[model samples]
Target: MSEDTNATDDRLRLLIERIERLEEEKKGIADDIRDVYMEAKAVGYDPKIMRQIVRLRKMKPDDRSEQDMLLDTYKNALGMA
Candidate 1:
């Protein structure tokens, strides 16, 4: 193959290898998170609600407040309040 073609192939291979490494690292981190959640559950904490709390914590306060208001409105509409 031409030198330019070889260089392009090498770059592509390096990019793919980097992505694969990152994917494996991501999977390991996910497993670690799952283990933490399991530990929380063993300690009598609800993992589902824990996940929701984490998600809400990641959101801006205003955005979370808006979501809470909408949820309350919907619940009231359904006579769940």
Candidate 2:
């Protein structure tokens, strides 16, 4: 193969390897999160609510407030508030 072709192949291989390594690391982190949630459940906390709290915490405060307001508005409209 030409030198340029060989260089491109090496670059592609390196990128794929990096992505594979990152995917493995991501799986490990997810496992750790699952373990933590299991521990929380064992301690009498609801894992579902814990997950919701984690998700809400990741959102910007204004976005979260907006969502809460919209949820309340929907509930009120449904007469379920």
Candidate 3:
């Protein structure tokens, strides 16, 4: 019974370590993506709109379509048609 407990503890510790490592990796990737966005902005690209496009792409298709419709409507209202 004691051996079983020790084995379980070891497994839990390993899993936790793996999760922590993955979280750190995710943070690094997010930072890298942010850096790319900054570079794009420096090149005269609109980072805010670029980020919105990227975020919309990650959403469900239905949601993306709805957002697109709303944006088009707004643009038309603003005479940017």
Give the TM-score comparing model 1 with the true structure, all chains together: 0.97
Q: Summarize candidate 2's per-residue lDDT along 26-47 as a digit string, tens digits.
A: 9999999999999999999999
Pairs in steric clash, model 3: none
| Model 3, runs deviating above 4 Å | 68-81
lDDT of model 1 at position 42: 99
Q: What tens digits encode model 1's per-residue C-alpha lDDT throughout 1-81? A: 999999999999999999999999999999999999999999999999999999999999999999999999999999999
TM-score of 3: 0.75
Instruction: Sort by lDDT, best first.
Output: 1, 2, 3
Candidate 3 at 6: error in angstroms? 0.4
TM-score of each: 0.97, 0.96, 0.75
**Candidate 1 deviant stretches above 4 angstroms:** none
lDDT of 3 by residue, 10-78 (tens): 999999999999999999999999999999999999999998889877999998889889999999999
Model 3 residue 7 CA deviation in Å = 0.6
Q: Per-residue lDDT for 22 in model 1?
A: 100
